[model samples]
Target: MTRIGLSPLAWLDDVEVQRRAAGLRRSLRTRPPVGAELDLASNDYLGLAQHPRVLDGGVAALRTWGAGSTGSRLVTGNTELHEVFEQELAAFVGAASALVFSSGYTANLGAVVALSGPGSLLVSDALTHASLVDACRLSRARVVVTPHADASAVEAALAGRAEERAVVVTDSVFSADGTLAPLRALHDACRRQGALLIVDEAHGLGVRGTGGRGLLHEVGLAGAPDVVMTTTLSKALGSQGGVVLGPTAVRDHLIDAARPFIFDTGLAPAAVGAARAALQVLIDEPWRAQRVLDHAATLAALCDVAEVPASAVVSVILGEPEVALAAAAACAQRGVRVGCFRPPTVPAGTSRLRLTARASLSDEEMALARDVLTDVLAAR
Candidate 1:
């Protein structure tokens, strides 16, 4: 055999070594179908991922529509299931319309890029999700990143922007810290500056607001002319895909202009059906949202964390990547699974364990969580 030359990607080995040295390496673990571990790491806030009705919805859709969407939504991929899901989702969230995407990331990309372009200004929160950050990059808009949840900063940016067209972007509930953005204040600011507010409700939907209609709806901003919202079905809905909710004109415009929406294949039938089922569950069982919040409060109290979470996310800052990793491992040893977040996911020196509360967690599971978290934190 002929000797092969050194590969061009050989430098990636050094990068991996650096990551390991910095304690920032990440790996995936395949979870068992039925595990003994108490799940605190997953985003299944409402716990509908394993619900019988939700599963049945997916199964029925799979039998009827096959596994794939078949093509882009502009083509043969636009099914009756998609239209029905969209209509139901829009009505449930009090939006004028909704456009579904393959994932939350792509939905953010499509909404941000399509709404703002060269000569427009995008005022994004500093702690906004990475999806929105990437969308801002792709937008080619003059981007101004303000301090986290600071409405004044957003207002100032919007007021000072040279461009007449502006969009103020923020997360309704920040994913890492679980703190809420001042939605009312931000909306008022946007209104004064004639700017549109784009809120990513990924963490807020099915966890916050009245019956999980979302934070915007709770604040009376849903269906507002100047507001746009994007959310995920994979999180609270316990399914897969994303939706951009706003005015009818915005939906039509995205249909025509958004590259991600135009080029990407539509969401599969199973996800659409499952998400619709989950939405209905949320509607019928409003208490599920409250249960998750109560659970999060209980976990936070047991963890002795200073800040109370506004949603299902409860973060316990450990100040170092290695320490957070060790803490998570300690919890795992006690049959509790928690997420360890480090730099890039979170800022350096603020690495932490991210725990998500589930509505379906039993009393025994809650007790176990409290005990495990208390023991782990005490050991530190």
Candidate 2:
């Protein structure tokens, strides 16, 4: 074959250089199956990822269902396990029905696209998750991005829109900043405008509300006719997959109209089993939710973070990508694992150490974390 003089892919090299210059390049590190480092980087808020029951559930499902889902859910992939999960999940969250998906991103995509089309309007929060942003883009609706957590802005968008069908989307708890959206106010606005409210409870389900039923449940909007909620099993549930909980009509419509739910393979048997087990664990140990929030508050205090975080995430802004990376490295060297978020994941000049609180973190681990984080911050 003739040697290509200049590959079209060469532009990637320049992009990589630019990223490095801005300290925005990202790389992954391989982690052992088990480690000695104190884990403040994971989203295992309830510490159920390695729970014996959760593990057993996954193992048993894997043995029974084999390795894969086999086909799309509409085909051979739907199983008794998936059906049971949907029913239990819907009941637990006070929804009339639920639809499971392979991931939270896909769930949001399906919900947004299925609910809104060319004649509809979608009002989204400016600081919602990337998945939601992508969903908004793919929705084929008239999209208006409102100021973060501004219910008035959402109302205005709805009021000004010509479309009769409108959907206002927001995260129950913001992922990066660990702040809560005004769900009750948003619901009032949606009701006033005859619109539907979609709340992403991925960060709220296991960390907010009474007994972790989620923010919507806490606010009495769980079974509201105009409200739809989506959440992930990978975070607080310490498993994998996503679910959309809403009215029975919404679920039926999604089954027939949502492309992601219809075209994608069903969630793996092991994930469904694990999530079901974790949900049961949450039900039995409701106090675990409060423990996670308490741990997060302790972590935030140790870092002098001013914001009272509403969930398990505690962000300590370091103001520069290199600074945040160095801080995370320092924590890791001290046997404390913390997450460093740079540009793209966070705003420029607001790079941060994103610490997650787990209910299973021991007193000894907490003390160690406090000391390590203090030293890291003092060094700055």
Candidate 3:
């Protein structure tokens, strides 16, 4: 590959410079298997990722199933664990059927595109996850982006749409600020408009509703034929992979038509095992969910926030991305680790420090976090 006057990719340098100037550049930091830092950053809300039972389950599955799933689920990857987990998860969430995917990203991609097509209309929230955004882009449907958490706007779009088939998409617990979608109003709107509702419960599975049955179950819409749900095993479930739960017909359609599900490799056996075990832990120790919420409330109060968030995440907004970065560094220096979100992880001018509340956070860890945040956020 010979270059001409300038390399074809030379614009990347300019892009990097622009990103650095705008404080949009991101770098990865390697974390140890076990760290001493007081962690308020990760999404392990119930701290089940480190639980002995979960680990043992993963180990057992690893030993029994080897490492990889071999191939796509159509060919060889669908194992006994996948079937059992899917059945259990569907039953837990009150869905008729469930289908597993390689990752939450692929799951979202598969669900959105499979459910909505060229002739369909998709009313998506402004602040949905990037996966869903990309899914909409690939869906080929005429997408109408509604204002963030505006059920009225969503209803308006759905009500006035010319397409008979419409799908409304949103996150149950938004990953950015940990705010919740107006699910009841949205569901009502969808029902009124005769549209299907797809709720991403990625952050809600191990944190929200009774025993973490999820927001759908909390609001009595879990088994509704028009309602579909997607979630991740990585976050609260403390594992890996993703799932789509809904009517058995929808599950059958995804199996046959969703590109991600048809082509992508199946979920690993270890993740299936871990998610199953963590889910059981949640069922047995329902207090874990409430503990996470209580921790979130405490974090909000310590940060001097006026109201607590709906999920196990609390957002502390600082102005510029640079300012947020500095604040995060200060907190880390004081032995507290937090999520420093900048564009495009968050919208411009809304760059914030996202804190996670883990059920297993010790009193000492909580004290350390409280003082560190009080001292650090004071400066910003």
Candidate 4:
């Protein structure tokens, strides 16, 4: 008779037990393409996903190019559509040049790692999106995490760094809480330290700045030699892609050096076309940006949140993960859809209902949302 060790894979059962006990389990649910639910959970802030022109743009590309990009961008996937869209994006954002990636996550990885490495210092905002946090870890630079949205902390990190090269990365609008960053102050600190600044405008594009040109353009730092910006087409442009905008040299460098860009497939033709059409729409309908902001304010008031959201996101912290989950269920049961964020997505004890405002929501829709949210929150 002998004692045997637990099976190698059996530990997962213990982990599951711990997760359930901590109330951290998560699962996904499907929704009909056309649903009765009032959606404030999606990232389609401008509500362009169903816009006729946006659909037509994607469809036209599909008819011509098929579904997938045939190969990596460097080899066979480069198309006229991609080049044109890159140019359009650069002009729209007032950048000297632009390069597109398959996703915002890849775009952040490319820009951060290409701009930094060993002997360089990377200063990152603690509250940045997870994508950026992952990018910093992969950069192989002397990494320093500063207080959330504190430009002075960034300055100190950059100023005292022994490395000759430095890069500061932040989100223009924090994704979880929708807090705005001090872009101006951050840029000034980077300038003083002669460090490069990278701002991810994933939440700010098509929802901030005049004409949805993005927070970098809004702050007059769009084409600065020491500055770069990354954004997603999925969130604002109603398409699936990512972009890095800055000096032409940076684009060239990424094309040669960035592992994510060099090895990854180019963005699909349909996404490029949809993004281009969506950009034109944004140019024509600049008011959509302000309208979404207005809608966020309305949601804040309805939920009794004190401050109006800085971007389209509004977070209503409901304590433990289980509490937030129940509240989200309550909203869905009442014909409204909102996002529920728990641990890993957010910190412990700060689980929340993350609401996103859409520009295309009709007045009646807004009223419905107000009633549902008011009742749901009041119950909580």
Candidate 5:
């Protein structure tokens, strides 16, 4: 028998084993209950995930179109539901046109790569989502990371390279902190620099703007020639898929050029139907968005009164990774489940218990969540 040169692989496994021993290992949980529990850990900002109409639409689409979209959109999977959702979403968000993809991850990948090329410079916020980072990597563009949410930093970066084609990208709402970006400043800077601005409204839609039109519309940047927006239906819309809304020419270009949209499988019919229904619910219940924001503000106030930093995600900051994990476990033990963000998910020294707010939670439920969370933080 010949011994192979696998020492590097052995060292890698050894590091993983050490990480597990240090109370830093990661694992997945099985399906949680859907009953009468306070949920402050989900992204269903408007509480449409379990809406009756959304559920019914999903069921109807499943039965009518079968389980899956048979092929890629460019193949046999392009269906009427996709077209309808695209049109409705574009009109609702005030975009010139829209193109849907299988997932937000793919949409970001396709759009970022397609729009910016070798000669292009991609200036992105340092705290932008991982999807955008992946897209920049795949684009092979000259990438520059600006300070998070600092439009002045973005302006400085663009000023240094005014001659190169550029695209400015950032999340409308920072997912971790729930901080809103300076969209108007960023848009204005990009426009002046002759660069395109791409805002990922994954957290903003159904939670901001008039009728949840999103942060861009809230900042009066919607329908601008230099702005493009991408969103996920799985978040606020309580469905699964992603869309890029921009000019008609951009959509046409994506139809021919976006590899993820053309080469990947189309979104399931159920998701399309559920998204459409969710949008209708948003149209009918515009106040739901405000209610969610109100709930968030209330929770933030509760945290602040308790002397904790008021997180947009309503997180309880724990200085150490184990302390954060222990705090979350304590909450779960007391009949409340929350998210624990440690290294990799969080920065090196800022592990925390992330609590997402939703409109569905009653006042009593929010109070209980606060009571339980306060106890957990004190114990930590």
Candidate 6:
């Protein structure tokens, strides 16, 4: 037996193997133009991502604080803007406190890993985002992935795991299918089992609950001592960052123990400012929440009218991955941008076009989207 050299490392290829197994992988496109066609694929629920106010707020922060945080939160990076944003966020989301992170992915990673460790058991939904799944892996906790949105399955996983601390984690709105988790039922189960419930309301924050307070509050679990929620500012807020909100003690624990917050550079001042502004906008325009939900239902109804099986995402089911990709391509070609959920991203045999709705969409835009979607699906 001999060790492989750097030259042999070049021959060792997982990229080609994955390509053969999963087809050609997609690459990121550079900053897309706002003028490019109708967009039903982005997570900009309130259409505030490119709003003048948001841009101006971000620009002001950038000018005041520079381009990046000088250091991590525990270091010199903790800015006054970050503090203000967190306080505002906590108040808006009905949490005792909130801790902001550089990205929502890092926020989930830090929260999950810090809250549940080697002697802990983490039960998560099968349909959760990749970030949560990765956090479970990094936590070194005993991970039990239950059936998607099945509270009973979750309960069963915690039935006899008394030796270790257990936490039930789930996404409030699953990204791929746009389905919601049974937050109340999961909370009940966790409460019964003496476990903590961590709800990922990344998609839910701007789209669900009363006035977009989120699923946890809507289900009467927000202020609960045992219920913790994490959300992304990049979505509804149209800013880039993540925050974990819960009781003061839990937040204090995260401040001291969460590696992402302590070790990574604090969220940029611009992002914090933008998030603050976005939250303020939400407070002023409470109707935005209802608009997005209404848009989602409208998309679903149009799919139904077109004889397409639609879920919370209003996806046009394309049996084959290639078909889904092609459909997405066709939509893009027709100046209607949409999302394509395929293998690995979506569960096996559930490839489809995932179209998200926004409060900013005019009635005519939605009608155009429906027409394009129906035509695309029919052609497929």
Q: Give the number of the best model, judged by lDDT.
A: 1
lDDT tens per residue, model 1, 1-380: 65489787999999999999999999988899987799999999999999998999998898899899999999978899999999999999899999999999999999999999999999999999999999999999999999988899999998888898999999999999888999999999999999999999999999888999899999999899989999999999999999999999999999999999999999999999999899999999999999999999999999888777789999999999999999999999999999999999999999999999999999999989989999999998
Give the clashing residue pairs of candidate 1, or none: none
The lDDT values for all models are 0.94, 0.93, 0.93, 0.92, 0.86, 0.84
Per-residue lDDT value at 194 in model 4: 94
User: Which clashing pairs does model 3 show?
Assistant: none
Please, what are the lDDT tens digits per residue for candidate 5 over residues 201-233?
Answer: 999999889989998998898889888899999
Model 1's alpha-carbon lDDT is 0.94
Candidate 6 C-alpha lDDT tens digits along 1-380:
67756565665487777765665477684546655689888888888998888888899999999999989988899888888888888887788898899999999998999999998899999888999999999999999999888999998889878645899989998887777788888988998888999989999897787778887878787778988889999999999999999899988999888988898988889998888888888888889988887788888776663532222256666767777888898988888888888788876677888888888999889889889877887788
TM-score of 1: 0.98
Local error of candidate 6 at residue 220 (angstroms)? 1.0
* TM-scores, all models, native as reference: 0.98, 0.98, 0.98, 0.97, 0.94, 0.94
lDDT of 4 at 265: 93
Better of 3 and 4 by TM-score: 3
lDDT (10s digit) by residue, model 2, range 164-274:
899999999998888899999999999999999999999999888888999999989989999999999999999999999999999999999999999999899999999
lDDT value for model 6: 0.84
Q: In candidate 1, residue 21 scores what lDDT?
A: 99
lDDT of 3 by residue, 160-279 (tens): 989989999999999988888889999999999999999999999978888889998888889899999999999888999999999999999999999999998888899999999998
In model 5, how large is the Cα lDDT of residue 146?
93
lDDT score for candidate 4 against the true structure: 0.92
